[model samples]
Target: MYTEKVIDHFLNPRNVGIIPDADGIGQYGDPSCGDFLRVYIKVKDGRLVDVKFLIQGCPAAIATSSIMTELAIGKTIDEALKITDDDILEAIGVLPEEKTHCSNLGAGALHLAIEDYLENRKDN
Candidate 1:
């Protein structure tokens, strides 16, 4: 069963889109598993000024990704990088045991995005 927060987020997912000029973009998930997610971020002054996501997944995946954006925005890159699957799971309340892996979707992609940003920064 899903929690109220989970259902709410799934039903009305937030930050569900793409950032064309994203400072960083990252993807996570295996095609064979059916859940794939892409996270885009805009960083300004070492902080995440904006965040968005696109996902091909179930309710849990959508909800997790939705809440992750809320958690990451306004956070410093260091702070955002610290976000974890457990953090998102906590913020969203609960996910079925079988769906728990979905918690990784957002945070994983987010970390990768930050890494991408750092990599791109180094090249410039």
Candidate 2:
């Protein structure tokens, strides 16, 4: 049975969309599970000014992506990078044991986007 918190998130997922001119973008998925996630971010002055997500997956995946974006926005890149899977799970209140991997996808995608942004900055 899904927890009340999970239900709330699933029903009203946050930050669900894409930033047209995102400074960074990252995508990841497992075809076997049909769980895919894409995260977009806009950074300014070394901070995550805005964040968005586009997810094509189950409720858990959608909720995780949404919550992750909400957590990342307004955070400095360093602070965002420090976000762990536990933080996401705790924010959402509850996730099925087996569905925990979905949270990883959200966190990994966000980290990847931040990494891409950092690397691109270095290159430029």
Candidate 3:
């Protein structure tokens, strides 16, 4: 079962697009599972000025990806990096135990995006 927040997010999916000039990009998916996620971030002055995501997955996956972007935007890089699966679960209000993977994927994808940002910054 999904919560109202989850359903709302699923239907209205936030930040569902791409950043053409993204400062950072991260992707995660399981070929066997058929769920793919890509998160794009625009950073400025060590803060995540914007965040967006493109997801091809289930309801939970879509909702989590949507929620993750909302949570990341306007956060400092360090603050966004600390976002966790539990935080998403709490925000969404509910997710069946079996679908917990969706939340984990959201958190992991965000972290990976941050990692990519930091790495890219290091190189530049």
Candidate 4:
């Protein structure tokens, strides 16, 4: 069963959309588990000004994406990179043991987005 926090997040997920001109973007999925997550970020003045996500999967994935966006907003790029699975699980209050992959989905997506932004910036 999903926890109250998970259910609440799923019912009223936050930052549940896309940023068309996002400074960074990341997408990740597990074909075996059928969970996919994508994160968008807008950075300003060396800080993460905003974040958005699109998730396709289970409750945990939804909750993770929602909470991850909330946590990443306003953080410096380096600071945001420090966000981990434990941080997400704590923010959501609880996660089903089997659904721990949701935390990874969140972290990996954010990390990939940041990496993409950095790489593209270097190319310019």
Choose the strongest candidate by lDDT. 1
Q: After superposition, how far is residue 47 of candidate 3 from its true place, in Å?
A: 0.8
- The Cα error of candidate 3 at residue 31, in Å, is 3.8
Off by over 4 Å in 1: none
In model 4, state the lDDT of residue 58. Answer: 86
Clashes by residue pair, model 3: none
By the TM-score metric, which is better: model 2 or model 4? 4
TM-score of candidate 3 relative to the true fold = 0.95
lDDT per residue for candidate 4 within 1-124, as digits (tens), equals 8888889898899988899999999998965768989899998998888899988888888988899999999999899999998899889987778988788899899999999888888999
Worst 10 residues of 2 by lDDT: 1-10
lDDT of 1 by residue, 29-98 (tens): 9868799999999999999999999999999999999999999999999999999999999999868899
TM-score of 2: 0.92
lDDT of every predicted structure (CA atoms): 0.94, 0.87, 0.89, 0.89
The order of the candidates by lDDT, greatest first, is: 1, 4, 3, 2
State in Å the error of residue 124, model 1: 0.6
| Model 3 Cα lDDT, one tens digit per residue, 1-124 | 7788999999999888999999988888874777889889999998998899988899999998898888899999999999999998888877888888888778888889889989998998
Q: After superposition, how far is residue 37 of candidate 3 from its true place, in Å?
A: 0.7
Give every collision pair in model 1. Answer: none
In TM-score terms, candidate 1 sits at: 0.97
lDDT of 2 at 32: 67
**For each candidate, what TM-score against the reference?**
0.97, 0.92, 0.95, 0.94
